[model samples]
Target: MSIKVENLKHIYAPNTPFETIALDDINIEIKTGEFIGLIGHTGSGKSTFIQHLNGLLKSNYGKIFINDLDITDEKISLTDVRKKVGLVFQYPEYQLFEETIEKDIAFGPRNLGLVEDEITQRVKDAMQLVGLEYERSKDKSPFDISGGQKRRVAIAGVIAMKPEILILDEPTAGLDPKGRDDILRNIKEIHEKEKNTIILVSHSMEDVAKLADRLLVMNRGKVEFFDTPKEVFKHEERLKQIGLDVPKVLDLAKKLREQGFDISDDILTIDDIKLEILKNLKEK
Candidate 1:
């Protein structure tokens, strides 16, 4: 769904001596089915901003419109907002508490008052969407799985609700390389097949480089930039000044270019860089 934010501002502990400005005069637009990478350093308002999208946190200074409806209106129900926007927080597995994986993933659909058959179908679809075998995992306790599996199960719970906009916050945090790869694969698969709008809030510049169609860079409670990743990553000095790094692949490309290897500075993905290296080496 399309989302538009106008003059959004959020403050914590307002009117207090320890008050902090969490979000400031922020405004942006998102198209339906677009993959947006929300990037920032710690305390850059990334977490706080996503909360406002699903109405978990309300903004008093501005309004948010989802599909042209002002969610800030008193008549809008938070439940309706949440149904359209699903949020998967960092280390989501920590929230899983059901007796079986099937039950855990089915929780959201069940809460939506779907019939038992529909809930069961949702549980199966969600599990498969995350790369888990329905028959093998359905009966297992959530606690018995590996860390990554448990994390997927948690995400499956949110996916079972069939949200139009999926927001994942630091989805690959605290995982081994293999586990991180698995989760990213699931994310890619779901986005490609389901065609849902995705907003990925992450600190990993490399992950954003590989996954996001557009980049939204935030710094010190303000939007530093919002554009395509290629355009945004061009501001290497500014990003570094704000405590963010360009993608590692881009850094490698720069070093390779300096070493007399012909390559573009805007290279963002490892696969593209690898091909460039192979082609340049052949020319050598």
Candidate 2:
């Protein structure tokens, strides 16, 4: 589904002593089947922005449109908005509370008043989508699963709702390297197979560079840059000024270029760097 935010502004604790503007005239447009990455340091309004997409947090000013429907309208149901846009918050595993894995993953559809058979079918489908064996683990307690499994269960809960757009906030946070990679791969697979729009909120430049077709950089409640990863990462100095860094490989490529090497400064991945170096050596 397409998402559009126009002149959005959000303020925390309005009319209070600690009033802080979290979003400042933020405007963004995301197309269907696109993977967009949002990057910023802490307190950059990334979290607050994603909350607005799913109607979790209402905008104080401005409007959000999902597939041409104005979500900010009072007549619109927040539940309907959420059904179309699923949000998996940071550390989602902490939110798993059901006794069994199947029950936990089925909660969303069940709450929507789906029939028991349909909910069961959705639970099985979600588990399979996340690479879990439903029959083997359906009866087990979610608490008894490993950290990665628990994370998958939490994601399955959202997937069971069959959202057209999936918004993940720091999906790799607080996981071992293997666990992080596993989750990232699963998410990528789902995006590829389902052709769903994805918005990834993360602090890791490398992760964004590798996954996102476009990047949005936020600073102090404002969007500083919105463009392709190559365009956004070109402003290394500006990003650093805002307490962000480019991908490590891109930084290294920049240094190599400074040293007069025949390499592209836009090399954002290890494979790209290796191929570039090999091609240059062959030409020499």
RMSD, one per candidate, in order: 0.9, 1.5
Can you write out model 1's per-residue Cα lDDT over 42-116, one digit (the tens) per residue? 999999999999999988699999999898888999998999999999999999988999989988999999999
- The digit string of per-residue lDDT tens for model 2 on 1-284 reads 99999999999999999999999999889998999999998999999999999888999999999999999999999989999999999999999999999989988999999999999999988888888998899999999988988989999999999999999999889989999889888888889977899999988888889899999899999999999999998898999999999888987787888887799766888889999988978897
lDDT of 1: 0.92
lDDT of each: 0.92, 0.92
Flag regions of model 2 displaced more than 4 Å. Answer: 258-260
Q: Distance from true position, residue 261, model 2, in Å?
A: 3.6
Query: Once model 2 is optimally superposed onto the true structure by TM-score, how far is the C-alpha of residue 88 displaced, in angstroms?
Result: 0.5
TM-score of 2: 0.95
Off by over 4 Å in 1: none
